[model samples]
Target: MAELVRRAGLPVSAEEAFAWHERPGAVERLLPPSAGIQVAQCSGTIRDGDRVKLQVSFGGVKVPWVLEYYGYEPGRRFCERQIEGVFARWSHERRFEPDGPDACFLEDRIDFQMPGLWPIRSWAERRILRGLEKTLRYRHDTVAADLAEHARWRDRPRLRIAVTGSSGLIGSALVPFLTTGGHSVQRLVRGRSGEHEGHVVWDPETGQLQADRLQPLDAVIHLAGENLAAGRWTAERKERIRASRVEATRRLCQSLARLLRPPRVLVVASAIGYYGDRGDELLDETSRPGRGFLADLCRDWEAASRPARSAGIRVVVARFGLVLSPRGGSLAKMLTPFRFGLGGRLGGGGQFWSWISLDDVLGALLHAIMTDELEGPVNFVAPEPVTNAQFTRTLARVLRRPAVLPVPAWALRIALGEMAREMVLPSARVVPRKLEQTGYPFRHRKLEWPLRHLLGRQTPE
Candidate 1:
């Protein structure tokens, strides 16, 4: 058996630090994006007999691994052992030790063995150890950073929030995050068909919602909208996009405005696409909207929230950049081609791409929720924005693949039409001025670190 251990200091009580791990989305948040692994099913808690099944795909091969929780200590220690997986044996113990009154140390110990020939086993063990080192290090940094962020609101009272788009990617992640942070999450669903605990049915299209259900909400995070990248920008597709964002938002805001005790804050989702096709122009919240279908859509979309703002509720329109994650979004689509060494720069590769890690996006949203001073437009992006070529080269480097081919602008225009021009090739050097001014610290400021963490890529010490 091989044993490995790692430790990190967190600025929170041992109990609080451990509780963060026990939360619903902790595992998903900790799992490295580029690792080609995903939680297929989970019992949703870290208790004895609870199980988590993970699927790992690499080079076209899919492997399923199952872990069963055994040791269960509320705040000090817990253990999980492999019930079914690739290894001959695998067990991991996590311990939280009090370092100080307001701080704690988190430790991870792993014991594992390979089920192969002796010679091959030795080599495999070394590789596994290296991989574990990277993975655990990432987990440590992520948890520590998250705990630190949470520390800022340590004394704040828990809030009850109503969130739309609860099933979408950001919403799914955000709901668990809020719940884990001691907030009550009430999901606003479109229909009563899928109703469950904490779900309130509403119809955005008809502007119908049970006003009583939304009473006493501290905030409302609106994320429901038709996906802009679902298809080519046909006239019909554009209409769906516009209606989904503009009309839905207008209706939701109108309803919220009429509430006797409306939520103190309304965080509506917008896109950096608002500043459309500006070549090399540095954009902040104050930057004027550009021209194009997306820009026009964003203008109307953001305008839809005026009712709630006019009603004295603080409205924050989060203009998001390219959100990077392995599970979905633009990054996921590019991973396969890059891994196959067919990755290349798109449309001259000079367009500046303002990007943000999925975690950072969530952080910015939470910050917006907590910080009253953050009103109007806030750019949810990392401090450093990279050009398309720089992003491509960095990704390829992390994947250890060649990225030499450059897709011509004409080819992209031919293939994807307006989308290729406006969405893919447009330049938006956006900066998170408001978030920074409000003292929101980004967990992932650069592309390389996040890319390495997600992909399980090793960096030389």
Candidate 2:
């Protein structure tokens, strides 16, 4: 059998570090985005005989891996062995060794034998080891970041929160984040009462929800809305977007206000589009809304929270810039063309595009719910915004691709019509003023490293 062992120093106690792994979201948080590893079945917590199932998808192929846990010693070590998978024989042991009350070490030891004859097995082993280094580094970094953030809020009480659009990009990540942090999450799915299965029932379209269910919640995060870039700006599409944010939010908030005991905090997702095309202007929460379909919608969107606000709910309006992750959002859309070396700036490449990694977005949301001081509009973008040209160049550098194909304004306008002018070519330089003031620990403070980390392109450091 071949062996691969890796170890990372943890800043927390061995027990503390072990608990983080024992939680429900360890697999989700640890897996690299580019790897496309899907959880067929997740056995939450480190327990004897618990089984975890995974399918690795690459180049349009799915290879299943089943792991059954054994040596489950809490605060010390846990072992998992492959029962069914690609490798001929495999065993993994995750051991947490204590250094002191404040420090520990996570040792990941793997023993496995590759399938096939000597030459083929040797080549496969070499390839796997090369890729494994990057993945392990990412896991170590993620664990460290998460530990730091949780440490900051260590004294705070755990909360029971309800989230709308739980299946959406942000909500999906946020749920696991909160759950792993020891907070209970009740997903607010828009389905009939009995159909909820276990989720909280709520339908903004019909304004139906059981107020009693929300009475015990500590916070509510509303993220349900039609996707802005889903299609061209047709009249019908515009109405759906407007109604989804304005009407849906208004109805939901009204329901919350009427609750016997409403949640203390309510976080509503807004967009940097609320700032409109400001033409190189550095915008913040205090900045007035600019003129546009988006800005107008945002005005009404925030106003819809009046019911909740008037009822003493701490309302935090998170005005998000482009969220970067290969899993979804604008970054996902850009990946295909960019990977093929066709990425380039739009128009003059002068317009600023403020953005944040998916990690920061989730961090900001968690901070919002936890920090009582954060209220009203808060820009949730990286402190330093970049021009379209700078972003293109950085992205190309990360992917090791040359970006020579710049999409001209006239062509974009012709192809995308109104969307090309409003979204494709607009600029808004935004910064997270409230998060900065409140000392929200940003996991990704810059772009290049975050991009590299998310895409599993980390260079030796």
Candidate 3:
């Protein structure tokens, strides 16, 4: 049998650390996002006593395993051991210590042997251990980042920030960002009461957020709305989409208005679709709303925040562009077809696609929050805009594929109904002039670089 150990330092109280250590789903959230573990079932009353049963997937194969928690304690320590698993043997321990009067530290030590007792040789085992160590280092860094964010929140004036659509694509990413940034984040979950991790229960359909929930606050970032490009925009579907954003915004803004201590700032989510299909036209924050379902919905969505503004809250409307993420989003989805040598330019490749990396979008939102000068409409798009053809070429090049096919406009229109013609074919050459003018620097400024980075093609030297 072979052995390895990894550890992390966390800035938290032994008690607070214990709570997290004991909390259900805590370890699952902390598990590396890249780990392909299926049926990750954790059960038992104790953190160290819980058995974790999972099938680890590697190289198109699944290895089943079971672990048992052996050591148990409330705040200081806990440990786990492999009962029966693919590993020859495995053991881990968690230790919490007081770093200072206000700061605490957590250490994680894991020792394991992989691909158990075969002719797999010592060299391969060492290499695998090295890789495992690298992954553990990443987990430690992530934990440190989380701890630092929580520290910032503890040090700042407590602000109650309630968020809607907290489980959606943007929300899922943004909530973690906000919480780690030291601001108290409460999700407006559907049905339930009393805040947990600053989460508040609110039914957008029913217009219900416990009035007291919004009483204390510093700012509001309204990102709740139906996804525009999820499905075909039938007239009935369009109504549901439009009503979801408008009604939810109206209800939340009204609720904030009723609060004794309303948030000082209201940063609401809008979309670049407000510009519609203005062929070859450059649109900034001041562009007029175009004529379309999305255009009308965005216009109304921003207007829904008026009640909060009228109630003396500083309001900023974020007219967002296409937000790209590595795990999910249009870019990731497009990678599949391109990787298989099937990706091609869409609809003559003439339409302009103005987009922002999800990182930049979140950064811009945080910038808007910190910078009091930012108000009114802010375009959350990258500084550079690329044509559809350029996008196709860049993506294909990144995947080492040939972009020889240009999907006809009629074909797309037939497949996607009005959506293809409107969403996929429109050209809004948007620029983040306002954000740039405010001294906000984009981490990802170009399409090719971000795409490459997202696709894991740009290896480190």
Model 3's TM-score against the true structure: 0.76
lDDT of 1 by residue, 1-461 (tens): 89999888888999999889887778877787656788889888999999999998868698999999989989999999999989999999999999988899999999999998999998999999998898898888878877787778988988889999988778877886777676788888877734466788779889898776654889999999998887799999998889989999999999988888889999999999999988888899999999999999999999999999999999999999999888778898899899999999998899999999888887788899999888999899999999999999999999999998878899989988999888999999999998888899888898998887777788646
Q: lDDT of each model, Cα atoms only?
A: 0.88, 0.87, 0.74
Better of 1 and 3 by TM-score: 1
TM-score of 1: 0.92
Regions of candidate 3 where Cα sits further than 4 Å from its true position: 1-112, 117-159, 194-197, 213-215
Clashing pairs in 3: 48-69, 149-180, 153-182, 186-198
Per-candidate TM vs. native?
A: 0.92, 0.96, 0.76
- Lowest summed lDDT across 10 adjacent residues in model 2 is found at 189-198
Ordered list by TM-score, greatest first? 2, 1, 3
Among the numbered candidates, top lDDT falls to 1
Candidate 2 lDDT over residue span 146-213, tens digit each: 88777778899988899998888888788878887888888888666555444878888977886655
Candidate 1 error regions (>4 Å): 53-64, 114-127, 193-195, 210-215
Sorted on lDDT, best first, the list reads: 1, 2, 3
Per-residue lDDT tens digits for candidate 3, residues 1-461, read 56666555666666665665565444543554445655456672355457878788878798877878767877788888888776666887777787766556677676766663456646667876775665566555555654544453364564556677767767776765665444567677776655354567677776777766544777778887787778898989988887889988888888888877788888899989889988888888887889877788889988988998899888889998878765565675676688888889888788888999765776687778767789998999999989999989988887789988777889989989888877888888998989999988676888876665445454334
